[model samples]
Target: MKIHSIEAGNFKLDGGAMFGVVPKSLWQRTNPADSNNMIDMAARCLLVENGDRLTLIDTGMGNKQSEKFFGYYFMDHIYDLDSSLKKAGFSRDDITDVFLTHLHFDHCGGVIEKKKNDFYEPAFANSTFWTNKEHWKWAIEPNAREKASFLTENIKPIEESGQLNFIKQNSSFATQNEMDFDILFVDGHTEKMMIPHITIGDKTFVYMADLLPTAGHIPIPYVMGYDTRPLLTLDEKSKFLNEAATKGYYLILEHDPNNEIITVKHTEKGVRLDKSLTFNDLFN
Candidate 1:
């Protein structure tokens, strides 16, 4: 299997919200904010090329939303989903699976597109969109805290297109094993967020979804405020990061603007960042 880093684009989010309870003085040292107190973030996705099947993880914030809706996030970047795929020598039709980490607009909005007169439809007609069943139910029937992030235009179209598939719990599925690897699911960010764990070449890489958005978030307490269950997030993060450090797993960051992947090392101060490396650099 081959892995490609598909950069959808860049967007700005409030540094305060991204850092949660961490003070600006702390987080700013790593992810410095602009004059507007907004930090740069990347809508990075991973592509898996295995034989005739191509799997894409987390489509970026799509262009289907209205200008007013798009203005809020400041989606300003030259890279986009289609353009990136073209650069990778592939097209939307090549995608056999769309593995969503969660239904947040930034993560899954690109799954569907808005046509003339604002009609929404599936963006990838040939792909069987994969999302965990538990998360699907929670998102379609969203609570007040997350309703804004779960847009119907981005979701309903997949189900309507008859391409939606669910990953069964406690059992393996074809897509999960497509990479010749396993995926890790965790709640707290959103229900059943899928994190792909793969043995690429000789190294093990974990796609760090919103679970740890940036390398600056390695300090354990630096979870995003947007999380629905902050307390559960804290617990989940502690356990995951500790194991990641002990096992020397490389974390492939999704939202980090600068850093892409890093490995952790345990220290007296608790779990901490060790070394940063790009995935392609592994070939050398």
Candidate 2:
């Protein structure tokens, strides 16, 4: 199996919320904030090409939101879902599976598009949209804290389109064809967020969703302020990072615009980035 970093786009979000308890002075050094204290965030997704399968990990915040809605999160960038896929010698039609980490707008919004009647519909007609049963229920009946992130318009369409498929939460490693993977579930960020660990060319690439968002967040206490269960996130990060360090896993950062992937080293400064470089840096 081969992996390609498919960048959908970039948008702005409040730095304070992104960095959590960490002071602005610290996070600002890695992810510099703009005048409005909004830092640029990547809508980076991953595409897996394993034999006949073309599985898309996540879709970025889509273009379905209205002008007023988009003004809040300055959505502007060189990369877009379709164009990026095309550049990678693929297209939306080629996608066989859509593996969503969760139903959050930034992660799954691009699954659907706004219709002329102001309703949402599936953007990829041929793909089987994948979500765990627990996550689907949580997103549909979202609580006060996560309601904004779980937009019904972005979700309900996959089922309506007759392409929604639920993957059972299991302990045994799950494989769709020969591309075997183990799901690491963590509830700190959101309920049942599935992080996929896949072996690639003698290296394991663990897609670091929101658990460890950027390189700057490596330090234990640097948890995101937006995390629903900050303490749980602390524990999750600690365990995951230690495992990554022990196995020498390459962490694929979802939102880190500058450093795409990095190796971690347990140090006097605690778990920190050992080296910083792009995914191409690894392939080359």
Index of the highest-lDDT prediction: 1
Q: Which stretches of candidate 2 lie over 4 Å from their true place?
A: 171-178
lDDT of each: 0.87, 0.86
TM-score of each: 0.96, 0.96
The candidate 2 region of ten consecutive residues with least summed lDDT is 171-180
What would the TM-score be for candidate 2 when compared with the true structure?
A: 0.96
Task: Kindly list the per-residue Cα lDDT of model 2 for residues 1-284, writing each as its tens digit.
Answer: 67899998888899999888889998898889989999888878999888788889899987888888888888885789999999889999999889998889989989999888787778887899988999889999999999999887887887799899887887523445556677888999888999988886578888888988888889888898778899999999999998888889999888888878899988887787888868688765
- lDDT by residue (61-127, candidate 1, tens digit) is 9888878877888888678999889878999989998988899999998999988887888889889
Q: CA shift at 180, candidate 1, in angstroms?
A: 3.1
lDDT of 1 at 233: 91
For each of the candidates, give the backbone clash count. Answer: 0, 1
With a 3 Å backbone cut-off (N, CA, C), the pairs that clash in candidate 1 are none
